[model samples]
Target: MTSNDLGDFLRARRARLRPGDVGLASYGARRVAGLRREEVAVLAGMNSDYYARLEQGRERSPSPQILDSISSALRMDDEAREHLFRLAGTVPEGVRPRPRETVGSALRQLLDGYPNAPAFVLNPATDFLASNALADALFSPFESVDNLARMTFLDPAARSFFTRWERAAEAVVAALRHAAGLDAHYRNLHDLVGSLAGESEEFAALWSSHTVYGKTRDGKELLHPDVGPLSLTFQTFDVRGASGQQLVVYQAEPDSPSAQALALLGSLHATRHQGSATER
Candidate 1:
């Protein structure tokens, strides 16, 4: 375990939050940014000194109840709350198994069936283990699409590809944070974080905020090179019997412009694949 990692995470998170964010009034000039240490204590229903101790690394273990209270005070989502527990070296019982990196043959076949939609499988660390042709075309601009988080933060094309790039970046970082908390010993995740932190100041700032989240059904807007702008809905599903693997599928509403764009992207992918096969 990295010494003081918990303290560092707590301090960073605290620094990013504001008094007004937690329903507290800002009455006077404040020297520091975010909620003061005492304010967090008050909101969390804990002693100020004790909360300080936790942030200062003097307090190592906090009860689940206390952690829950603190998580609430911090306005943490479910994933972020779980990350807090993990940082304290006490994950709540019955946590699901961490997803593995491998994508099974059955899953690959399922993805192949989605000719129009873009679909792929990601491990807990956001590694793209397998993707269908349409999915490949969707992310074709990236020099490498090995890791979604890395691509979002480090790839130049990401800014254009994701119409709302800043929001997309935050979501990616939060998802990575949740994954890191789930498996701190994941070497690949550690390396990926280290690399992104070193290379991108934006990524570093977001990572320090210690936010946590997971992908679910959501709308995404992207600028595709071949098909122009696309507005699509994406849904992520847990690959049953495959720990730490999630299958993400992207689709557009019927008869929408996005649907037409998707069709064009599919045609382009098919043409390219056919050309390559003929050459071989």
Candidate 2:
């Protein structure tokens, strides 16, 4: 990892955009790839020399306002914008550093309340901090589901488990990329990305794209050995006290076949737990 990769990141993002992408008319022969330096400066409402300095790593401390402007000019998403702020050595306003990773007892109880819903908590690095029984059942097919990105990219079962494997893979990689950028100094995350990049070609290709995003409110289609196929919608909520942890809940449509499957799975899980207690 370079001590200052900000220049490389900025240049890559800039090269990804075209003159027409930022509402600039494309006329005459243009030699430069993507938007020119002057074009970006004009769009960002900053001086070309200053912007060039930023790209050259000569200007290390850009104000939040300027970073925000550049992000806007580049059509960056929320995750990309956050990454830009981090590279500038400043946190964006209203964004706080992630707190310690701890899922409170109350939150665990809340997960219990959702017996029909598959719920789990994940740290910023996608580590499985905690999970409900249904969530356990849902992910039971995987040999290991400790890290979501690993399971998605490294596990062969993931191909079948996630019906839309490509989409799931992309989302997982993007989220991990987002986290890694924000906490570049995190050794574990660096190791995780390195492992994935080395082990999975798909992961390596996507990682180079530098796409970043948090989990979104989207439905997932899954295939379970016992239940066959399931369609579930998932929502992610930030844990009140835990900074970088999020509670993700998966729910099936009411009275639908997927819901019925979940109910059956819940019953099976409960029976197994009761039997285990009885044996003890």
Candidate 3:
């Protein structure tokens, strides 16, 4: 985490808000977009100079009350507010050892249970630790299913594979930011973010926005090379006894077209696997 992450987050969130967003009247043509520094300070009931010092990184330590005021002024959501506290270093820190990336045997068995669905395991940094056969087939279009962030922003196939490409991009970046906040000292996470920011402009821009979110349950629209269009809903579960590991399972509604498509994809995947094994 950079020393200026807090400031950058504050600036980004401030830029997203308009004068009228906080019940303030717009008077004349403003030089910058959204609320100005002074305006934010005013909303927070603090002097602009203090807020300026905080934004400029001159003020390193801020009290919880002050952070709360800033969070309220910026109209941050729960995740964003927690992230703000983390960046400001006002939240109590605990000893969080780096989590193992390996998925357990039981989890592997669980993933296998979803024969027609795509189920995979992901680390905090969004690395594809392990995936079931169906999940592998779902992501077969990518050259390598290494990292979701890389595949989403850097891969050519992602644009076509993800029907809502923009939303997917935003979501992955936001989830990464959330992970960074929780696991601040994880070196691999830092390296992943740095590499992505250097490679993809869109990722860099979204990262700068400081949008922090964790995936729990979400619906996705996907266009598979083999199966064509599919609408799937996924649920993410934190794996017990595995720190920073999440199990994601994607399913299509029963008796729906998407379900039929998923079944067909599974059949094709099984046939290919069987043929490969027979050849071996």
TM-score of every candidate: 0.92, 0.86, 0.97
In model 3, residue pairs whose N, Cα or C atoms come closer than 3 Å (at least 3 residues apart or on different chains), thus clashing, are: none
Between candidates 1 and 3, the one scoring higher on TM-score is 3
What is the lDDT of every predicted structure here?
0.87, 0.85, 0.91
Candidate 3 structure quality by residue, lDDT tens digits, 1-280? 5769889888889999998889999888888888999999999999899999999999979899999899999999999998888888765667665778898889999999989889999998999999999999899999989999999999999999999999999999999999888878787789999999999999988988788888799999999999899999999998889999999999999999999999999899999999999999
Maximum-TM-score candidate:
3
Model 2 clash number: 0
**lDDT over C-alpha atoms for residue 220 of model 2:** 98
Instruction: Pick the winner on TM-score between candidates 2 and 3.
Output: 3
Query: Model 3 Cα RMSD, Å?
Result: 1.2
Instruction: Give the clashing residue pairs of candidate 1, or none.
Output: 99-243, 99-244
Candidate 2: C-alpha lDDT: 0.85
Candidate 2, residues 51-155, lDDT tens digits: the string is 999989899999989999999999998889988888777964346664466778999899999888999999877889899999998998999979998999878
